[model samples]
Target: MENQEQKKRDTNKIYFLIAVIVALLGTNMYLYFQKNKSDQRIVTVSDEKTALQTELEKLETELDQANNSTTELSTELKTKDDELKAKIAQLKTALNKGTLTAGELAKAKEDVKQLRYFVGKYTADIDDLMKKNAALTGERDSLKTTVSNVKQLADNLSKVNDSLYTKVKAGAALKTSQIQIGAFKIRNSGKETDVTRASTAQKIKVMFTVANNPIAEKGSHDIYMRVLDPAGNLIIGEGGSFTANDQDLQYTYKTAIEFNGDAKTFTLDWTNRNNFEIGTYSVILYADGYTMGRGSFSLR
Candidate 1:
């Protein structure tokens, strides 16, 4: 009986040893599996964080590029840009943490997705603004060109009118022709006789016919006469001054004639206070700021 009891006790010890070994193996296996799952979670979180960080940086770069465009942003657009930048900054701060819980990571993912949508909308808004600006610029340029063309056309018309006025003014002047000069002597009885001798001459007579010009000014027209001696010196008679060919000139005689737009002949007489010279004399007539006609007579 002692030998049998001892064998049974040895068998119970082996079975307990086997159960303990099996329990230890099961506990170790469970610990190993749990550790492996934790490592994978950590790696996944790290990779996700890195990807989010990369995306945030890319969004920031795009924002900066949009700001660098040539078009100036409106006040509202600038505010939106600032808000987006702040959002990026906030996201970056969140992603910079060393560790993230699953809930936090999932929240970050949602935020990033929303950020992408907002960024796409922002870019679309910028494109629309740029297109509008381009169209406005084109319209402004076209308006300027139209204004310039109109101004040029007005200037051209003004020049043409001025030219026509100048021509019309020039065409309205009166013309004189058939000028004749005669010398005469007045006897003591007050009778006149034609004479050629300078010493015997006491009066000078001038005759001319005016052309019919309907455009010329009607009414009484003042006529001025200038007499030049053989030496080319002007003979001062009345010492009256008149303007002719843009020059102030002294006249020897002046008279008035009535003009009614009909061809007419007129005569004038002048008695010199000084003695006449024995040479050729030149007589020029002026009317309305123009030289009318010239004539010559000899005196002896």
Candidate 2:
């Protein structure tokens, strides 16, 4: 009976010990499973956080891209451009927060939406400004063209007035007729007599009759004479020059005449410095840029 009892006690003790070991193993498994569950929960939260960070970064990059065009706004819109840049900076700050809840992220997304809308409206405003600027430029160009045309018209009218004045002045000039030149022989006593022989000539006489013109100016006019030798060379006296109708001519002699619009005869003389040539010599008279008379004389 004692042995049986002892065997029973030993079996009971082994069973109890096995039950305790089994209970301990159960507790360990429960704790391990709890730890694993907690770890998995943490990993899931981290993934959500990573996704939020990625989304925030993407939204920030998009906002930056959208705001980059603000620099293109004109000076008049600089205030609006600055405001938009500030809004973009605010969005970036919100996205960069260390701990962002779902509600906060949702609010940030809402803000991003508002920013996108703002950017769209700003773009529209910029478009409107550009259109207005183009219209103003066109108007300015049209005004310039109109001003240039007006100036050209005024210049043309001025040119026409000048031409009419020139024509009127030319028409009012005095005329002359019956021009004659005579070669003369000079006596030792300074008396000149008409002669045509080269050996006997010592003086030249020029005579003309002024024609009556009702419009001629009543003034004293200086007449210039050109004497050309047979070789078409000028027989210049004292050096003198005058410009006539954009042409300059050298004169050999000059005389002053008074014009009162009445036809009158006049005579002038040139003393010979050398003996007369054997060919024909020419004489032309000019006054006030007008050819008063022309004549030629021959000597042998």
Candidate 3:
């Protein structure tokens, strides 16, 4: 009985030792698994941080490429670019840490996702702006070309008008022909008779015919006659200075006649206050700022 009791006590002691050993082994396994789980969590957080940082770097590179692609940016676009860069910088600052909790890593992932959306939107906006600017530039260039063409056409038309005006002005000048002069003697009855003797001549009769022109001005025309004596001096009466052939010329007599672009004959009688000289006298007709015709007569 005593041996049996001692053996039972030894068996109980062995069972207690076995139970303690099993508990210790289970505790060690729990600690090792906990440590491994902690290491895996740290590695996951670090990998997430590296991924977030890489995404941010890519975003930054994309932004730089966008900025370099265009010639100029609008004020609004520049402001947006600055805001995106600042946001990326802030996110990078947060991600640059050596470690991150699960919550922090999740927040970082969400932030990067939102940043990607914003980057896409920004790039699309830039493309749209570039397209709009290209369209505007094309329109401006086309407008300039149209204006230039219109100006060139106007200049050509002006030149043509000037040439036509010059031609018309030249075509509207008057001319005279068939100019003749005769010395006449008038009695108290005022009936003139032809005479060659200087003493017998009381007046000189001048006749001329104006040529017809289709383009001449149809109005009352003032005819100017200049009588030059044998001494090459103008026989001035109640005449004034008139411009003819770009010259300030003194005329002897002036008369008015209605002209309708038809050949017309005119006669003028001039009576000198003094006796006629026995020499040749010249007569010139001027009208419309030009010399028309000339004639000469001699008295014995």
Candidate 4:
């Protein structure tokens, strides 16, 4: 009877130990699974952060390029560029906090996508303007050379003529080699705009370059211009007068330009209070009793 009692106590103790071991195994398994799930979440968040950082690097590179050329940047475009930098900084701050939920992460990615689109469009606009400026530079260079050649030809012709011609040419003649005239309207924003409408025209711009001459007098020469309407009536300027072509002529306007014989470009602005007619108008430039160059333009 004592042996039977001892066997029962030993069996109860063994069953209790086996139950403790089973409980320990089940707890360990559950903890391992939970730890692995948490690690996977960390890895996923880290991957997304890395991707966002890479995108930010690309954006910074583009912005650096724009800032380097900021002098040539338009005011409106420069403002947009500054706004983009602020957005990038904000996004980086959020990502660094390590507290973003899945939904917030997704929202950040969408914002990045929109920013990239904006960058692409801005770059395209800048490229287009660069191309236009390049073309204008090329044309201006060609115009300068052509004007120089015209003056050279006139000097050569004078040398081959009679003594009277040579004597007349000895007097320094301020010669214009190129003439460009355009009718423009000033916008409310204070920008000059070329317009086809005659009534809307507020200003006429004249551009020319004086020719280089070793013998030409290097002094202040009064350059005069005559703007004749399509009907052949002279559109007088605000002030000044000069004689040309064996007649006492009252010039429309005149400016005293100091000539040192090196060819240089000049700009003349005319604000015509009188209305413009819808027809071709002629512009004649004169200096020192000599016709410098001629240009013409039409308005609709």
On TM-score, the leading prediction is 1
What is the C-alpha lDDT profile of model 4 across 1-300, one tens digit per residue? 999999999999999999999999999999999999999998998898889978987987887775675348789878988888888888888888857888889988998888888887877777776777788888898898888898898887766676566456645677778888899999889999988789888889999998887778787888888889999889877656777755677667677788898998899988888899999999988887878888999999
- How do the candidates rank by lDDT, highest first? 1, 3, 4, 2
Report the lDDT tens digits of candidate 2 across residue range 1-300: 999999999999999999999999999999999999989966765676566456545545644554465335677566765676687677667666666676776776677667667666766776776777788889999999999999999999999999998888776666676898899887888777888788888889898988887688898988888999999999888779986656899988988899888898888889878777889999988877867778999998
Number of the candidate with higher lDDT, 1 or 4: 1
Q: Give candidate 1's error at residue 191 in angstroms.
A: 3.9
TM-score against truth, every candidate:
0.79, 0.66, 0.63, 0.48
Window of ten residues with lowest summed lDDT in model 4: 162-171
After superposition, the stretches of candidate 4 with alpha carbons farther than 4 Å from their true spots are 1-16, 157-300
Model 4 lDDT, full chain set: 0.84
Better of 1 and 4 by TM-score: 1
Give the clash count for model 3.
0
lDDT of 1 by residue, 208-263 (tens): 99988898888998999999998999999999999987799999999999998788
Model 3 Cα shift for residue 260 (angstroms): 2.1
Clashes of each: 1, 0, 0, 0
